[model samples]
Target chain A: MTLYASSKAALRVYSESLAQELSSQFPGIRVIIVEPSGFRTEQNVLGYPMQIPRNPDPAYDSVREKSMQLYTSLDGRQRGDPEKAVELIVDIVRREGKSVERLGGGRAESPIYVPLGREANNDLEAKCTKMIQVVQKWKDVTDNLDHDDTNSVDLTRWGALRFFFLGSLHAYRAFQDRIRALASAGF
Target chain B: MTLYASSKAALRVYSESLAQELSSQFPGIRVIIVEPSGFRTEQNVLGYPMQIPRNPDPAYDSVREKSMQLYTSLDGRQRGDPEKAVELIVDIVRREGKSVERLGGGRAESPIYVPLGREANNDLEAKCTKMIQVVQKWKDVTDNLDHDDTNSVDLTRWGALRFFFLGSLHAYRAFQDRIRALASAGF
Candidate 1:
């Protein structure tokens, strides 16, 4: 589960970066991330048979049992209609039917993400909310993690020189500001 | 850069999950994620050379040039002290020196993450802030993505049965609530 979840997360981030990277050079190119929840596919319905692992570790027994039960029970009972999902996806891509209205009649930019079901939407929203909450909770500690003398005049010349020479345009500008500040302070 | 960044993200998430998974069974075990920025190691200082690709594409020429210039200039001038970073990491893991006070005299739990430099802290904070801003911007759309008839009585018996039989404990509770609601509605 951990591996699967992490891989999915990596794919999601990669897609997002791809979308951003392509947007400036290729405005016509659209990268839409479709997150579907429990479509009634053959795999979801009957492919997941309960099979105990031959060398299952004792520590993971409970989790294994629970997951097995869950998958077996959910088989063939998923709420999502695969055919309807396909139709909607096609419509979204072609800008037809109700999707045209939802997409603002080809005037507005399409959303980067389109969660296809109630479960998908809820799960995504929950994850986002949880992330926000965790970050907020640790905001103070995270903000204060910098070295104490980050802005001190005692910053080494090598440090300043590196920024001036090798840094991006933004870093160069910042280095210039730092130099100006140091000069004003008679350093 | 995208691949590297996404892989790092995946590793971070995987480590986080590992920490959570092991916490219950292994109370004595600690998982520490150290994010260091621009340490004056050989790699940061002199390892990167400005090497042009043999078959460079014209489209990426600008970016390639900029990155090369940036890296070459920054060589040997990175601000972080590798020795100091190592010392700090050791102190944190050993619960010694100033870390004792910072960690509350060995009574409080150690932080799961230890960002090592000013740049790392600022970048992490910025990332978190940006994430919060993006999620907030799309809150309405995300919250409203559920199927219109999510709570309708038309939900198939198979769907309810799946939840009752195979779902997790939380899902089971949610199903019970839905069933009660349906019963009250004279379904």
Candidate 2:
């Protein structure tokens, strides 16, 4: 679970960066991140009862046992409808049906994130709140370790500019590629 | 930069989970995460003018050039004192020196995080605030995707309980091993 959660977290950050990188010079391109709760898919329901490790350490015995039990119980009880989720995603991408207005039509900026299900929403909301609280609580300690050198260059600003420049270069290359393809096709 | 940032983000999350896992059962075991801003280390000051990639893509030329320039300009100009950062971390860990009062003198809970410098603090605080704002903005979209099953079991709560149980089991095994070793050594 830790591995899975960590990978998902990494993907989330990567997608956000991708979205930011593409939005400026490539207005037609979009990077939408979908956060979905568990759905009652064949894999979730029937792919459990997995083979236990033959030489599992005794220290992890209780956790392993309880995890198996939990997985078994929740096999077919997931509360997400995969079909509806897919349909909504399609609508959002195509900008058709009910999602057209929900996605801000042709004027307002479209959302880069599509968090599906009450579970995803609640979990994300709670996580954000907890993070804000923790940072606020430790503000004093975090603010005291500087080297007393106020004239140093702001590296973060420079880093952001570098990324933005890179993103623009990438977008220009993609645009050139598309134009070349169109020209070859006699457009 | 994307790859490096994503990996660091993954490590942060993994460390947080690890700290939570060990806190309940192993009171003596603590996981401290140190977030350091750029310091004027030998590597930072002297490791510039790195070898350029042999077959670098033309699409990345601009970004690559700008990045090299930025790195050269910032060499030996970082505003962090590495010695001070190390000394403070040691003090915090040993609960000695001026950090004794700063760390609550064995009465209050110890901090699991050590953000060293103004840059780390400001960047983290900004990130947290932005996350909160984004979540709030998209609250409506996230809340509307439920499957209308109010009677579904709360899986997040169950997952938390499982981890806690696992942590306890691990702690018990560790305690038993310690006792056995002590007995054999005539302690």
Interface C-alpha RMSD per candidate, 1 decimal? 10.7, 12.9
On lDDT, the candidate that comes out on top is: 2
Candidate 1 chain A: worst 10 consecutive residues by lDDT?
A161-170
Model 1: per-residue Cα lDDT over B52-148, one tens digit each? 4533657667656765665665555555555455555557677776456555544344226665555555455555555445444444444343333
lDDT of each residue in B1-187, candidate 2, tens digit only:
5554566667767776676556655667777776666554434322345433433656556655766776566555656655566566667777877556555645434226766556666666676666556556556665564457664555676753223222222223333454465569795
Task: Find the candidate with the highest DockQ and give its number.
Answer: 2
Q: Write the per-residue lDDT of candidate 1 for residues A92-179, one digit (tens) a residue.
A: 6778864665566453452356665555554545545554454444444443433344432222333432232122222323334544
lDDT of 2 by residue, A55-170 (tens): 35576676567767765665556555555666566677778765665567464352367666666656666666665565565566655644677755566777532233222222
- Model 1 Cα RMSD, Å? 12.0
TM-score of chain A for each candidate? Answer: 0.69, 0.71
